[model samples]
Target: MLVKLGPLDAGRVADLRPYLDLVPDPRARRGRWYSLTAVLLICACAAVWGARSLDELAEWAERAPDTLLTAVGVRRHPLRWRRAPSRTTIGRVLGAVDGDALDREVGAYLADLHDASARAVSGQRRVIAVDGKALRGSARLTAARRHLCAVTHHRAVTLAQAEVGAKTNETAHFQPLLEPLDLDGALVTFDALHSVQANVAWLVETKKAHYISVIKANQPTAHRQLAALPWRDIAVQHTTASTGHDRRESRSIKTCGTADELGGIAFPYACLAIRVHRRRRQSVRRESRETV
Candidate 1:
């Protein structure tokens, strides 16, 4: 149950409840009294209200008022009693349901929600962020922590995700994580660790996508070449300054089109290079400056 945690978005619930019905029911109808959709909705509500575990979920359902249980479609007892499904029942249903089918249904719902916003605007590519995160609540069950690489929309709606091998880092799992997404002409952004030729090449040549990645010491040559650009000769194109909480911060940036002056940086599809200088100041004239 990959639920979005926050104050429950009533609109989101309404939009997604119908999609939940598409998840196939694993139980036979003759003996099954509980609706699978209702169970998922109850779990969704539990997550929204900050329940973190099975015990907590059961406790929440037991404590919930009759109105709340009924609102999420919990079945009424035949004698007109208020009732909710037990944690054991929730666990069995979720454990038995086809996870892939559930993900597909949810993905379809998300795509509908994203259609208006994720569309390309005047040929400008929409952004998708790729990153890995440690799965919460997995440590108790495994010797190694489970980590996942996810492709998400700019609004943080997860489009596709896959578990990375415990022995491997996110780099090796990048292609698989992104291949399922519709990335043509989209701009994908990732961190320095994923800035490699193979990734950029596949995105550009195979997927017809654009990418933005950080150049750090991990890619020594590109970092050195980009770092050696004639940044001092270029004027700052943008600048911003703000002061708050007894601290002051300022940043200025310079960008220049790549050309022969950069000595033809040996990087694929080299384009513009940018430099940003930042300064932070605390009390009593203490200051720190860094450039990247």
Candidate 2:
């Protein structure tokens, strides 16, 4: 399995050096002109800008700077570099390429990059957020909505993705989606839906990863145990405030160890129970308050 780097799009500095050589050439030598690697690289590079259709991808490649074209290995003819491949060519070649191979190689490269980044940051384990969402623009294709569960890095690189079954929910697909990645010693966070005992144990015992799970009404026993804690007796231990485009928000956190009065908040392998209160005031238009 190839442990790969993160996204290669703009604003995120990724090492695209190894990407060009990760996959083998799948085209015939008889009529090949453009480098297959260059085309694939262009598609990846353009992804962050939301390009997807063949026409849009090809257009982005054509407008690419000379430096990028040369770096991804666009052919340099005797007189000049050949133009980026056309939309028709891009469609044909990409259709013939091996998606599974590309995914593995990219995953390997991203994993390697994550490991190196960790070393530079004093060995702090990376954070992998596992979540799922409906595939936008696909509601018209299938009878049931197409949903996919995926794991992503703190830096926004996707490690893996798996389609959620029509007969099941995202929680059921969580373990399978994360089974393929190299997540040893990483910190995983998921919404309340995946805060089940089986999933948490699988992550710890099988994937060798730690998790920070949020408890809500989904798990009645745990939720009741946490909500019934003596929060009135505990002082707010930490507070974080942020100011953004049109809003100012603050969160005050109160944490209580499970060693003393609340020893029965049994959610499997948990040692602490925390509560967060959030207050948001958005300009002069809106305001809200919530807690978890």
Candidate 3:
């Protein structure tokens, strides 16, 4: 027989309980065997168990009494219990739960996990990939849509998440989500959509984080200015390599004798840019290049 444990056994679920206990609810009325702590545990466990609706949670509470009791750390023998929390009870508790506080706890857990994992690696820094995900059906109002902005450190799970209101643009909320994270000695990476100069500046200056943001047409002026400059003529030298059959190889190099004209990009103070390019070609017994 497979013995079952509770959501506390889950890695993410274990991280949430301690903080959930600290949340205060004044109008909470406890049942004979159930307490506020148990209620939160139920909710957290339900969330971990993929309980998206209140009826599902209530049904779990009724049918999985043993599992629920064990999860709540109940010592007494299971009673012939009925009248598990109604769906209304579940909804009320959810409404009372502090979303911001829960978000902070989840963020803290991720930060701790990141720190622990980083200690095992060789580098002195970490890389955080910034991305956004829309919660399906989370947008309740016809006019507002809910989106979650998340940061995931490379080679690890999610590091932090924040829910934005329907009307708030995600780019405007990106900084605040980034503000509490430990970005020192870290490299933050984002896509062209988040390549705002102000955002990049904040990552470097405010968070002390290095950034690598892709440039695209949204910033037409910046793109034009970058392309117009003579980067190929600068002292900044880059090497690219190509390989083929019979141990054949080719490499191209470039240099700017002076630093003034390369890219002509106005980076924030104390910031620098390096451009790299590479090409590779290989075949079993021979190699060929088709050039126009």
Candidate 4:
């Protein structure tokens, strides 16, 4: 696994250098003998093995001292010199590391991993999904629930994120997050709460990213007017209907007209309206058994 990571990648490990550059022993510092790089490597290796807290890493340092040294590019297997630094030291180093810098380095490394996977496959599918999720454990800080707005590309890899003070502030964070992302050719999806005129216009005008957003009661007037439009009136059309053998049925409708007309449609009216109709028919077999 360590070999798979390509340890020599300069860009990826640049953030790790600050701690690594420190001389572990002042007396041997001039000779470049002892360094914090070993310590940093040991802690990282321990964490990779599922060591959560620093205390666990300290225990690993004592047990696998030699294996840990070589894993981190410490030059050679070590003869345990005075015990490894306490858990507090490891935690402090990790805490003191600039989070932004670490995040950038980590993201870049992960990107490389994904890039390798992309190359291994003949054709690559890159999909970026943008959504807002509340920090599950964060206590409500105010009357409005604060949401963590994150733009994740390829699922769990978070490209960027911001804290939305409230529903109204979503647009503000959206702009900043989109500004830095390379969204061209990516299908971006969001919920009804973000289906604002300015937001759509921005996605079209600024990022060149395609968007598909849900429409809901939040835009009441628009929703009502859209519902009233004749589906045949549209140029491009989409329709879906489904039936299942046992207690399942579904209906879907979609249509797209000229961007000009879509733009002209008044807010709370139909630029685009999607209705999901569902009906579940109880199986006759189940009914017969119940009756008997």
Off by over 4 Å in 2: 1-35, 46-52, 60-84, 141-145, 242-248, 260-264, 280-288
- Tens-digit per-residue lDDT, 87-184, candidate 4: 76566666655544444444444544554565687776555667888866566555555577876655366656667774466766777766756566
Q: In model 3, which range of ten residues has the least summed lDDT?
A: 1-10
Candidate 1 lDDT, 120-225, residue by residue in tens? 4555457788898877776765466678787776667777667788678899988876775667777888888788888888988888888877788888898888
Q: For each candidate, what is the lDDT?
A: 0.77, 0.78, 0.63, 0.57
Q: Which residue pairs in candidate 1 have backbone atoms (N, alpha carbon, C) closer than 3 angstroms, thus clashing?
A: none
N/CA/C clash count, model 1: 0
lDDT score for candidate 3 against the true structure: 0.63
- TM-scores vs. true structure, each candidate: 0.75, 0.76, 0.65, 0.59
Task: Please identify which of the two predictions, 3 or 4, would achieve the higher TM-score against the true structure.
Answer: 3
Candidate 3 Cα deviation (angstroms), residue 193: 3.4
Model 1 stretches astray by more than 4 angstroms: 1-14, 17-30, 59-83, 97-108, 118-125, 141-144, 152-159, 242-247, 259-264, 282-286
Please provide, for model 3 over 174-283, each residue's C-alpha lDDT reduced to its tens digit, 9 standing for 90 to 100: 89888878888788888777888888888888888888765667878756655565665666355445445545454444432224544345544323443443333455
- Rank order by lDDT, top first? 2, 1, 3, 4
